[model samples]
Target: MQNYKKDFPIFKNNPSLIFLDSTSSTQKPEYVIEWICDYLSQSYSNIHRGLYDIAINSEKMYFDSKQKVADFLGTHDLKEIIYTYNSNYALNIISQTLRLNKVLKTGDKVLVSIVEHHSNIVPWLILKEEIGIELEFVRVTQDFDIDFDDFEKKYDEKVKVIAFTHVSNVTGKIFDVERIGKLKRPDTLFIIDASQSFPHMKLDVPKMNCDFLFFTAHKVMADSWLGVIWGKRELLEKYKPIFSGWWAINEVKKECFKPGALPFKFEPGTPNISGALSLLKALEYIEKIGWYETVESIEKELIEYSLEQFRSRPYLQLIGNTESKKRVWVFWFYIQGVHALDIADAMAENNICIRAGHHCTEPFMNYLKLSSSARMSLYIYNSKDDIDAFFKILDTNFNPTWLTK
Candidate 1:
């Protein structure tokens, strides 16, 4: 529909290739790529490290990028955002210190969802092992959305923290964060991993009411992700930096001690300046294209058509949300007698790129009795022709007998 493929250099570089793995990482737009190259070539310097104009200019651009990203998310408080290497790093920073706070003591409970990515689940598991905190998971329904009843059963005063994905990577089902956030106990903290949702929708922290949220840049069409972590300003101000570094210094006097302010307290080293700046450019591209509604409209139609086709194919088992309204363009499915890995290899020969794996959500896969499935994730650039080409290859030459035999 929108057809922005011309804006990405990758398609031009490989004209015959069809890429449908936007959930893992999006192809970069020309503007974002150019911005990164320009900064590296013309103005590369360590930020906040020198008095010279070159360094000052670098620092200005770096901080301004932060402000732009903050404004993009409908906040003016630059203090709320911290830059890190990726979503895993950002969430790890939170997991490292959040439990040590008075609120989440040993034996306190935490809740997660069955659809959570490994990055969201592993940190809590580590906290459980290291500190004796208890962990629980909300179930996924037969239709593939979060089971709110199960969520309510798992949530209570004993649960000191709750974390989940706003949009699942494998299913692309958008969760009602507002509904879940409201269910949180009075003192219980809520965290959201918006890695998939951030690329497809608009998010404002005040609206979400989450204590902390994180998303990776690469998934949003910015190459070489560093992540963005947003927290409630007051909460961040009181939280201690989990790691120590020279940049986290707040006082230098003898016998004087205090951690740095909001973002600086959390971001404790030389930052991902270029990646952050490129993410800002990616945001600009999204804004220029239009709001999430139009993007969602295109995706909903694509997903409807896709689900209809998958349902008609006797040999295929479609997974994820059954209704279009509950899902975005992401889909997962496995064909009978076809190994997911073998399917992916055959698709590669047909000049198509798709992902096949448990996708790091192995527990969820286990629940479905699926060892692996092929994933197709879409973007605004994808069109009906792309789907036709994808399905055509699958129907005709998916797994040659030589490989299958």
Candidate 2:
């Protein structure tokens, strides 16, 4: 397997650190970090507000970053991409805008799944309370996959919106978004949260048939506090932005105002210029490594190796599909009679970093009858050696008798 750890400086600084929580956030690459520093030091200015050389350059770089995001999502329309704080902010904007636009009225239904993160679920719940809309959830099968039968049965003309995650943050199971997107009615809107999938796979927005998709930059090795929301041109034009400011408007009177065009309308303030530039550099880093040809293969091999090690340790019970091919490298597991916090603290003491919590999916945890679980999510920098070391720690530290006792 390729050793991509050299690209990230964190591993070099902490020689014994074994980071296995990339699903939550990835460590920054040297390339992205340097670019951010250089851009801020050399050409830092507010964009679209000035015509000076540095200002023009900064504005160009910001839009260029947006264009790069558009290209990454396989969309030709740059105007369709809007910048926000994160996926959570993006979802809130969509829900509020749809409600304000009358696209979602009282008694309308929104279909989501039990596998969604709190970011996707809470917005709809709030909308339900505010607008009297009905919120429904599609169940998960025993294998930790979405129940398509339940989805189809619950979906009908009254279901005005369908929102789901492309990959479950806890299970790493990739949903069949194309199938669900294609199955929806013409008038129904489809929204996808690609926080876990965008960094690992190539997604074609037009081909997915979804009206809107959103993801955060931090998960893809970029800076945090930046996100992208890509929507269909017509849909974006139809919905008025819930938030407005000086840059987001064309004209304003004391009583009313006209919102600006596609992206600017939704983006209402001094944006995260450095965050966007960092995302551009992160995408470039992915391209440099040949994401589809190299990174994906490396992650697959790591998943297989990790699963093999997991199987040998019978005390560890995985929460999702046992097959590596069916999921990403994220694994959530538990030991009988051992608390998740105890396992995570033990791993931390051994210089291994893994996450332990409900993983922002309390509903899914409730569905599985689990209070919490320990998660180890792999990324490009992880290797078989790391997995072996992890298992070695487990073998030396945890035993069935101690766990049961």
Candidate 3:
């Protein structure tokens, strides 16, 4: 674990500062940063628009990034991986495109779980109201896991899409997407918000049996403001883009403005060529360092250890501890006598940064009857010492009001 910490620059540089907010965004490693710098400084050029050699190289790099993302997600069809600004944009694209194509219709229903982040929830809600599509949330079990039995019970022919999170950002509860997809009627499409899982666990969209999946590079220790969306090629072909940009047709000026085929149709702007290459480097770093080894090691040292540290605390309320095999090492908890914001601030003062809020899933918080919670999320770069430091600070129960002095 000490050797693993060297790969992430932030930990090596700021070893004293315990960072537990990986659910929000992870710190980029030196390699990811250097990769972006090298691309922008040495090979900087507009892709597909410039006639220079740099432009040709840039275009290839951008396209290769797409291929890398496809291979990372276990898909061979490079055209299925669409570049977007972020995971939120990717989800919106999926929702808007499906709604526009009438795949989501007036009488049709879309099923989502109660544990979804706002990113997963809001787009569908907007479409449900706009198209008069019925939107429903499947109930979660007491441990905050997807209620598979209830999901099966609620599922029916009227449901056209089942969009849910692969892992809950707040609860760290992992959804068995393969099992969830199997419960859906054959006609229904399965969409997975893989933001939480992609960074922490081994995932393949095909193995998960999802029709669509979204994840951001920043969350996965890659470049900022870049994300990947994977969908079935046929669905990408059939779906219309609601948020079209001029760059969508950069390659097809000779084609009289026909939408660029497959991925480009979804990626409608000057793509983040540098960011994409940086993401590739980050992906390579993850692979070379051994993703499964890192994931399991982090789970053992940070996630499981953190959960154990909090288990006996009487004032804390921990969510998402299930016997199911699907859970990743993420966990959310709230202090009994302390406000989540206050607790987070207290931790922050001690150089322990964790996240405290509704986590953009206001509806889920509302369902859980909590406006917010103090979330301690873990990733490969995190260690058991970070968890110990967090718990040590949390044990102090310092009131935020005292900081005013």
Candidate 4:
């Protein structure tokens, strides 16, 4: 019931805007924006190479942010974290580096679930095409939850790697990562895509037992173009740099060069300095606002309220788990005989933003026999009023007559 929208400037500017698409990207808070602007205007400089006052300060801030990221993820080792362009680039780094270093070879198997985003699937598919590695997809149940029986059956000694998402972007089902982590073979590496879950939950890398994990900053109220990759030191040191340049080199002769240390070897060239600062501020803001106690409680309340509202409307067919406690704030549903795009356009006309598409999981969509669905993802800034407004639009604008047609 608390009003958290005042922290976001977008709501003040667009009074009628009801944003329900935080899963795609979250709106920036005033705290993060002001910090980014102040840093850029007063002390902006390229990091790691300059020796002047501003340069030294900038380099310190950059590395301090990396350290903050490591601490936030429950890890103390700074060398384990690598900043990249985004989650897509991070996954590609892992795949390509493993392939080039011969860590992943032909005839090996990689296991993934059917409810993964393209970012997690495409790199492995390309690897399958390039090498002789086999790609297998675990099935999902009718309710959109992971079929753990099938997963256990498919997982074997041949599977050298297991890559999966912590939460499904389309279905909002929280995967049992701890269970899977315990089931993994000692020699097989486990990777996690936390882009969807990081914003809504508390994540500890050691507790999850993943060899590698990555997520984007934009989804957590930070600026875009920054992603974080955390891996075990030993595994990261085993693979050579997939892309090497000025900052990632240790020593350079005329013909060959040695790669630098853990993170620098992976993060080549000039990185996103301002964006990294923004992430530091964003994490600070979340902590200051009591992320676990306050932000998570608000999201849970919104989810329960939204599900209660959905129960009153028989026309709206909800997808995924119906129980509120089993999922996050993402919800996907459709009205029978109504095209998803048309529903989205109708909501847009009412100044309510929602997404209707495959949501980058075309294979899962194909499996469900659904081309598209309307998705409403909430965040800390949302409230029960937003849910009421969304249902109001559906009730008054879309009637039984229209639904039947």
Q: What overall lDDT goes with each candidate model?
A: 0.82, 0.90, 0.79, 0.89
Model 4 clash tally, residue pairs = 0
- Could you give candidate 4's per-residue lDDT for residues 180-278 as a string of tens digits? 889887889999999998887888889889999999999989999999999999988888878898889899999999999877888888999999889
Runs of candidate 1 exceeding 4 Å displacement: 253-257, 398-405
Q: Candidate 2's residue-wise lDDT over 47-113, tens digit each?
A: 9889899999988988889999999999967899999989999999999999999999999999999
Indicate the worst ten consecutive residues by lDDT in candidate 3: 396-405
Measured by TM-score, how close is model 1 to the native structure? 0.94
Q: Is candidate 1 or candidate 4 better by lDDT?
A: 4
Tens digit per residue, CA lDDT, model 3, 1-405: 543567777877876777778789988888888777877788899886888999998888888878888887888788998888898888888888887787888988889998888888788889877888888899998877778788877788888999998888877777778888666667999999999888877777777778999899998788788978899998888776776666665344554566667777877668787778888888888888876666666576555566667775655677777332457766787866677899888888888888888888888888878877888877777777777787777766642343245
- CA lDDT of 37 in candidate 4? 86
What would you estimate as the lDDT of candidate 4? 0.89
Residue pairs clashing in model 3 are none
Give the C-alpha miss distance for residue 335 in model 4, angstroms: 0.7
